[model samples]
Target: MNQEQLEGKWNQVKGQFKQKYGNLTDDDVTYSEGRFDEMLGKVQEKVGKGKEELKEEISNW
Candidate 1:
Protein backbone atom coordinates (compact mmCIF):
# COMPACT_ATOMS: atom_id res chain seq x y z
CA MET A 1 0.00 0.00 0.00
CA ASN A 2 1.04 3.60 -0.53
CA GLN A 3 1.22 6.33 2.09
CA GLU A 4 -2.33 7.50 1.47
CA GLN A 5 -3.70 4.02 1.84
CA LEU A 6 -1.55 3.54 4.91
CA GLU A 7 -2.94 6.70 6.47
CA GLY A 8 -6.45 5.73 5.53
CA LYS A 9 -6.08 2.43 7.31
CA TRP A 10 -4.34 3.83 10.35
CA ASN A 11 -7.09 2.91 12.77
CA GLN A 12 -7.12 -0.73 11.74
CA VAL A 13 -3.33 -1.05 11.91
CA LYS A 14 -3.20 0.74 15.25
CA GLY A 15 -4.28 -2.38 17.09
CA GLN A 16 -1.20 -4.11 15.73
CA PHE A 17 0.89 -1.18 16.82
CA LYS A 18 -0.61 -1.31 20.30
CA GLN A 19 0.18 -5.01 20.46
CA LYS A 20 3.78 -4.21 19.55
CA TYR A 21 4.11 -1.24 21.85
CA GLY A 22 2.34 -2.06 25.05
CA ASN A 23 3.63 1.08 26.78
CA LEU A 24 1.75 3.36 24.39
CA THR A 25 -1.83 4.07 25.32
CA ASP A 26 -4.72 4.12 22.84
CA ASP A 27 -4.93 7.85 23.25
CA ASP A 28 -1.28 8.22 22.36
CA VAL A 29 -1.76 6.44 19.06
CA THR A 30 -5.18 7.92 18.29
CA TYR A 31 -4.42 11.44 19.47
CA SER A 32 -2.00 12.11 16.62
CA GLU A 33 -4.90 11.68 14.22
CA GLY A 34 -3.24 9.44 11.65
CA ARG A 35 0.31 10.70 11.76
CA PHE A 36 1.47 7.21 10.88
CA ASP A 37 5.05 7.94 9.83
CA GLU A 38 5.83 9.25 13.28
CA MET A 39 4.03 6.34 14.86
CA LEU A 40 5.87 3.94 12.58
CA GLY A 41 9.18 5.51 13.54
CA LYS A 42 8.36 5.17 17.20
CA VAL A 43 7.37 1.55 16.72
CA GLN A 44 10.57 0.94 14.73
CA GLU A 45 12.58 2.36 17.58
CA LYS A 46 10.77 0.19 20.09
CA VAL A 47 11.07 -2.99 18.04
CA GLY A 48 14.52 -2.39 16.52
CA LYS A 49 13.42 -3.02 12.97
CA GLY A 50 14.24 -1.37 9.65
CA LYS A 51 11.85 0.92 7.79
CA GLU A 52 11.43 -1.54 4.92
CA GLU A 53 10.52 -4.35 7.29
CA LEU A 54 8.03 -2.16 9.07
CA LYS A 55 6.54 -1.08 5.81
CA GLU A 56 6.21 -4.67 4.70
CA GLU A 57 4.50 -5.60 7.94
CA ILE A 58 2.22 -2.60 7.69
CA SER A 59 1.28 -3.57 4.14
CA ASN A 60 0.34 -7.02 5.36
CA TRP A 61 -1.71 -5.50 8.17
Candidate 2:
Protein backbone atom coordinates (compact mmCIF):
# COMPACT_ATOMS: atom_id res chain seq x y z
CA MET A 1 0.00 0.00 0.00
CA ASN A 2 0.94 3.66 -0.36
CA GLN A 3 1.77 6.04 2.44
CA GLU A 4 -1.77 7.32 2.91
CA GLN A 5 -3.19 3.81 2.95
CA LEU A 6 -0.56 2.67 5.44
CA GLU A 7 -1.32 5.60 7.70
CA GLY A 8 -5.05 4.92 7.50
CA LYS A 9 -4.52 1.29 8.43
CA TRP A 10 -2.32 2.31 11.33
CA ASN A 11 -5.00 4.65 12.58
CA GLN A 12 -7.59 1.91 12.42
CA VAL A 13 -5.37 -0.43 14.40
CA LYS A 14 -4.64 2.28 16.90
CA GLY A 15 -8.31 2.89 17.41
CA GLN A 16 -8.94 -0.77 18.03
CA PHE A 17 -6.11 -0.90 20.54
CA LYS A 18 -7.47 2.13 22.33
CA GLN A 19 -10.90 0.54 22.48
CA LYS A 20 -9.63 -2.76 23.79
CA TYR A 21 -7.15 -1.29 26.25
CA GLY A 22 -8.66 1.93 27.52
CA ASN A 23 -5.58 3.19 29.33
CA LEU A 24 -3.50 3.64 26.19
CA THR A 25 -2.54 7.26 25.60
CA ASP A 26 -1.58 9.24 22.52
CA ASP A 27 2.02 9.19 23.71
CA ASP A 28 1.93 5.42 23.80
CA VAL A 29 0.64 5.27 20.25
CA THR A 30 3.20 7.78 19.09
CA TYR A 31 5.98 5.74 20.67
CA SER A 32 4.76 2.61 18.94
CA GLU A 33 4.63 4.49 15.66
CA GLY A 34 8.21 5.61 16.10
CA ARG A 35 9.31 2.05 16.88
CA PHE A 36 7.55 0.73 13.79
CA ASP A 37 9.23 3.35 11.63
CA GLU A 38 12.59 2.56 13.15
CA MET A 39 12.15 -1.15 12.55
CA LEU A 40 11.04 -0.50 8.98
CA GLY A 41 14.09 1.66 8.39
CA LYS A 42 16.36 -1.06 9.72
CA VAL A 43 14.71 -3.67 7.52
CA GLN A 44 15.00 -1.42 4.50
CA GLU A 45 18.66 -0.82 5.17
CA LYS A 46 19.38 -4.53 5.59
CA VAL A 47 17.28 -5.78 2.64
CA GLY A 48 17.79 -2.87 0.29
CA LYS A 49 14.07 -2.50 -0.32
CA GLY A 50 11.94 0.61 -0.54
CA LYS A 51 9.52 1.61 2.20
CA GLU A 52 6.46 0.57 0.20
CA GLU A 53 7.92 -2.83 -0.54
CA LEU A 54 8.80 -3.38 3.10
CA LYS A 55 5.31 -2.37 4.15
CA GLU A 56 3.75 -4.82 1.70
CA GLU A 57 5.97 -7.63 2.94
CA ILE A 58 5.10 -6.87 6.54
CA SER A 59 1.40 -6.70 5.70
CA ASN A 60 1.62 -10.20 4.28
CA TRP A 61 2.75 -11.40 7.69
Candidate 3:
Protein backbone atom coordinates (compact mmCIF):
# COMPACT_ATOMS: atom_id res chain seq x y z
CA MET A 1 0.00 0.00 0.00
CA ASN A 2 1.03 3.59 -0.64
CA GLN A 3 0.80 6.59 1.68
CA GLU A 4 -2.84 7.28 0.92
CA GLN A 5 -3.74 3.66 1.53
CA LEU A 6 -1.76 3.65 4.73
CA GLU A 7 -3.53 6.74 6.03
CA GLY A 8 -6.90 5.24 5.13
CA LYS A 9 -6.07 2.04 6.93
CA TRP A 10 -4.83 3.98 9.95
CA ASN A 11 -8.04 5.97 10.10
CA GLN A 12 -10.09 2.81 9.98
CA VAL A 13 -8.02 1.17 12.67
CA LYS A 14 -8.12 4.29 14.82
CA GLY A 15 -11.90 4.38 14.61
CA GLN A 16 -12.13 0.74 15.59
CA PHE A 17 -9.74 1.26 18.49
CA LYS A 18 -11.79 4.18 19.78
CA GLN A 19 -14.97 2.15 19.48
CA LYS A 20 -13.49 -0.77 21.40
CA TYR A 21 -11.58 1.35 23.92
CA GLY A 22 -13.68 4.37 24.65
CA ASN A 23 -11.01 5.99 26.82
CA LEU A 24 -8.62 6.50 23.92
CA THR A 25 -8.28 10.07 22.66
CA ASP A 26 -7.01 11.54 19.41
CA ASP A 27 -3.74 12.42 21.13
CA ASP A 28 -3.35 8.81 22.19
CA VAL A 29 -3.78 7.54 18.64
CA THR A 30 -1.59 10.29 17.22
CA TYR A 31 1.14 9.39 19.68
CA SER A 32 0.95 5.80 18.53
CA GLU A 33 1.22 6.95 14.92
CA GLY A 34 4.35 8.93 15.76
CA ARG A 35 5.88 5.94 17.51
CA PHE A 36 5.07 3.71 14.54
CA ASP A 37 6.76 6.14 12.17
CA GLU A 38 9.81 6.33 14.44
CA MET A 39 10.09 2.56 14.58
CA LEU A 40 9.71 2.28 10.81
CA GLY A 41 12.50 4.79 10.33
CA LYS A 42 14.79 2.80 12.61
CA VAL A 43 13.96 -0.40 10.78
CA GLN A 44 14.66 1.24 7.43
CA GLU A 45 18.01 2.49 8.69
CA LYS A 46 19.06 -0.95 9.92
CA VAL A 47 17.65 -2.98 7.03
CA GLY A 48 18.59 -0.58 4.21
CA LYS A 49 15.19 -0.94 2.55
CA GLY A 50 13.18 1.94 1.20
CA LYS A 51 10.15 2.92 3.26
CA GLU A 52 7.77 1.82 0.50
CA GLU A 53 9.37 -1.61 0.29
CA LEU A 54 9.07 -2.12 4.04
CA LYS A 55 5.53 -0.86 4.00
CA GLU A 56 4.61 -3.29 1.25
CA GLU A 57 6.29 -6.12 3.10
CA ILE A 58 4.28 -5.25 6.18
CA SER A 59 1.06 -4.99 4.19
CA ASN A 60 1.69 -8.39 2.68
CA TRP A 61 2.10 -9.84 6.12
Candidate 4:
Protein backbone atom coordinates (compact mmCIF):
# COMPACT_ATOMS: atom_id res chain seq x y z
CA MET A 1 0.00 0.00 0.00
CA ASN A 2 1.11 3.57 -0.69
CA GLN A 3 1.39 6.34 1.86
CA GLU A 4 -2.07 7.79 1.35
CA GLN A 5 -3.78 4.42 1.44
CA LEU A 6 -1.86 3.42 4.52
CA GLU A 7 -2.58 6.71 6.27
CA GLY A 8 -6.23 6.53 5.34
CA LYS A 9 -6.53 3.11 6.88
CA TRP A 10 -4.18 3.74 9.76
CA ASN A 11 -6.68 3.40 12.59
CA GLN A 12 -8.00 0.11 11.32
CA VAL A 13 -4.52 -1.12 10.56
CA LYS A 14 -3.31 0.01 13.95
CA GLY A 15 -5.98 -2.12 15.61
CA GLN A 16 -4.91 -5.10 13.57
CA PHE A 17 -1.32 -4.51 14.56
CA LYS A 18 -2.22 -4.30 18.21
CA GLN A 19 -4.17 -7.56 18.02
CA LYS A 20 -1.24 -9.29 16.40
CA TYR A 21 1.44 -7.55 18.46
CA GLY A 22 0.43 -6.89 22.01
CA ASN A 23 3.87 -5.67 22.96
CA LEU A 24 3.54 -2.64 20.72
CA THR A 25 2.69 0.58 22.50
CA ASP A 26 0.40 3.32 21.31
CA ASP A 27 3.53 5.25 20.44
CA ASP A 28 4.69 2.42 18.26
CA VAL A 29 1.38 2.28 16.40
CA THR A 30 0.57 5.97 16.24
CA TYR A 31 0.63 7.63 12.82
CA SER A 32 2.74 10.70 12.79
CA GLU A 33 1.93 13.30 10.16
CA GLY A 34 4.24 13.03 7.14
CA ARG A 35 6.42 10.56 9.04
CA PHE A 36 4.72 7.26 8.33
CA ASP A 37 7.92 5.50 7.34
CA GLU A 38 9.56 6.57 10.54
CA MET A 39 6.71 5.32 12.69
CA LEU A 40 6.64 2.10 10.71
CA GLY A 41 10.36 1.67 11.29
CA LYS A 42 9.80 1.82 15.02
CA VAL A 43 7.14 -0.88 14.79
CA GLN A 44 9.46 -2.94 12.61
CA GLU A 45 12.16 -2.73 15.25
CA LYS A 46 9.78 -3.86 17.93
CA VAL A 47 8.19 -6.67 15.93
CA GLY A 48 11.17 -7.74 13.86
CA LYS A 49 9.27 -7.29 10.62
CA GLY A 50 10.44 -5.31 7.62
CA LYS A 51 8.49 -2.32 6.33
CA GLU A 52 7.32 -4.00 3.15
CA GLU A 53 6.15 -7.09 4.99
CA LEU A 54 4.27 -4.94 7.44
CA LYS A 55 2.67 -2.95 4.67
CA GLU A 56 1.57 -6.11 2.94
CA GLU A 57 0.15 -7.42 6.17
CA ILE A 58 -1.76 -4.21 6.68
CA SER A 59 -3.14 -4.33 3.18
CA ASN A 60 -4.36 -7.85 3.72
CA TRP A 61 -6.20 -6.66 6.79
List CA RMSD, all candidates.
Answer: 7.7, 1.0, 0.7, 8.3
Best by lDDT: 3
lDDT tens digits by residue: candidate 3, 1-61: 8889988988999999999999999999999999988999999999999888998898888
Q: Report the C-alpha lDDT of model 1 over 1-61, residue by residue, as the tens digit.
A: 7666766676677877889988989789767655767888899999999876898786895
* Candidate 2 Cα deviation (angstroms), residue 38: 0.4
- Error in Å for residue 33 of model 3: 0.2
Candidate 3 lDDT for residue 19: 100
Error of 3 at 36 (Å): 0.2
**By the TM-score metric, which is better: model 3 or model 4?**
3
lDDT of 2: 0.92
Which numbered prediction scores highest in TM-score against the true structure?
A: 3
Q: Considering TM-score, where higher is better, how would the candidates rank from best to worst? A: 3, 2, 4, 1
lDDT for 4 (candidate 3): 96
Model 4 poorest ten-residue lDDT run:
27-36
TM-score of each: 0.43, 0.89, 0.93, 0.43
Total clashing residue pairs per candidate? 0, 0, 0, 0
Q: Write the per-residue lDDT of candidate 2 for residues 4-46, one digit (tens) a residue.
A: 8888999999999999999999999999999999998999999
